[model samples]
Target: MNHSSLDSTMMLTSFGSFRPLNYFFFSLTLLVYLLSIFSNVFLMLIIYFESSLHKPMYIFLFNLALNGLIGSSTVWPAIMENLLSDTQKMSFLACLVQIYWGYFYLSSAYTTLSVMAYDRYVSICKPLQYHSIMTPGKVKTLLTAANIVPLFSIAILVYLTSRLVLCKYTIQNLFCDLVTILNLSCVKSLLVNLCGACMLASLVVFPCTIVLLSYALILTVSLKASKGAQKKALSTCSPHLITFINFGVAILFFAVYNRYSSFLPAEVYILITIDVFMIPPLLNPIIYGIQTQEIRKCFVKTVRKNEIFFRICELTVFRKSTSEHNS
Candidate 1:
């Protein structure tokens, strides 16, 4: 806990009380991580390999799945490792990396959802112009913007945080985040706080505004159209709406928890922290997979195709064995 050595290593004190349940936590975390990886990867591959799913809508869903995978991979493994380790110590450099990607994961998520809202808006509100507006090149541009903006923006925050003089070497949470690291600073920089507030507005408020506007337009258009059109719009936007609400709630709770951690119980704090990373990644694929007809159909077809292939292999093996015995 030497202040001088804070530059080399920092301890995660959150794991101290839960040391006795390390095995249980490790098992549960591993399960969730595995499930998250499998679901996201499966959804991504389905969208990628299926030629029919190459439209703007499916493409956006694919990116969302990819984002979930990246976000989950960024933190879950570290949590799993720390749970099982005797020393819940992370190196200074590593903590910064986690904070960087952690912010990237969250910001990119909102931005991607914003982009998706725009896609749905174009598709439902301007069906004739959907393809023209969301051209492959444009899609690439939007995706690039979704990722790069968050990356550079977060890099600045992390850089500012890196220059701070720390009064403490221990973080109270399971994984590193900007707020936790900033709390440990010996003296808070006004500029850093300003940048963080601006970041919150840019990363959260701006994207949310875009989502609202896009959906509002879609809603207006849907109301004026035929029942069939209304149904189509509802089906298309429902999954995205559900996803946005789920993520929005998690972010809202996270913001509140970080600001008011002093007033919250330890168990509430832990649950909020874990839920931020856990629920979205774990449920996104499920929501889309279950709600989208094309995805469900493709998944069933895939399972049947694999089953048939395996059955054919077994039959061939049986025939070969029978011929060899007779000979």
Candidate 2:
């Protein structure tokens, strides 16, 4: 096999067997992609327009929605196009670009969730100092760090992986993931793997640990508070918790799929990969909008206002049509 040929193009084997149902899957994927976009955009709009929601929590929520949009946009469009095409091949550089953006998005998602957990913890356990501690400057700094750290980390990983000579070009996943790309390296990359593992652990495990500890503290404080206070805390924290758990499960499935790819069937592996990209973006806004009182109220108010506006437009059109017919 020519090494130059391997360097030129890589095949994504994940969709090789789905040719028969490509159109069906394409339609379904497009719908999911659109729903994810709409949900996140709606959440962001509500947060942006509602002055009442200008607090730190909603600010982080807005960033989370934005991250979801970025993450979905990074992969779904390519996946949809691949579903419609006969070839599942991508250039080597394109694969690297996908891997970088995909991992960067994942890192940012976890980091944002962890930050949101800390925000809730501070709000609940130290309400008096919430404004003082989570000031606009601080929130801005935290958001900057969340994004920068991930970008830097993934950049290093991609750089190291890119230096390797390739022995293979086929990736057995739905998308170009770092693990699959690393597996194609011709040379033994123990150091690369170890460095990648450390990066992954830092990006994922550290933030998750913070989230768990913060939630534990929040729960402890909630136990001592009154029923109403507890209910309020629960209402606020539940959405974050649900989103975190959903994201955590997806990450777990991803880890398992990577480590034990041989044991799992191709279909199962494809579904796991799809779930990682699909579920969080689709569910986060819905969970937050329904579970958070302020968001839900705003959503309801917005919907009702839109309904009234549409009704007035309909009446105007009806009268105009009737007048034109009479004339």
lDDT of the structure predicted as candidate 2: 0.88
What does candidate 1's lDDT look like per residue over 1-327, in tens digits? 333533668899877845677898899989999999999999999999999899878887888888888888888899888888888989877898988888888999999999999999988888898778998999999989988899899999988888877778888787888888788888878988999999989988999999999999999999999999999889888999999999998888888988898888767767876677878999999999998889999999999999999999999999999999999
Candidate 1 — which pairs collide?
none
Global CA lDDT of candidate 1, please? 0.87
In the predicted model 2, the residue pairs found to clash are none
- Residue ranges of candidate 2 with Cα displaced over 4 Å: 1-7, 322-327
Q: Score every model by TM-score.
A: 0.95, 0.94
RMSD in order of candidates: 2.2, 2.4
Candidate 2 residue lDDT tens string, 1-327? 333633689888777755668899899999999999999999999999999899989999999999999888888899888888778889888888988888988999999999999999999999999989999999999989888999998998887777778878888877888777777877778877998889878999999999999999999999999999999998889999999999999989988988988888988876776778888888999999989988988998999999999999999999999999999
Best by TM-score: 1
Give all candidates' CA lDDT scores: 0.87, 0.88
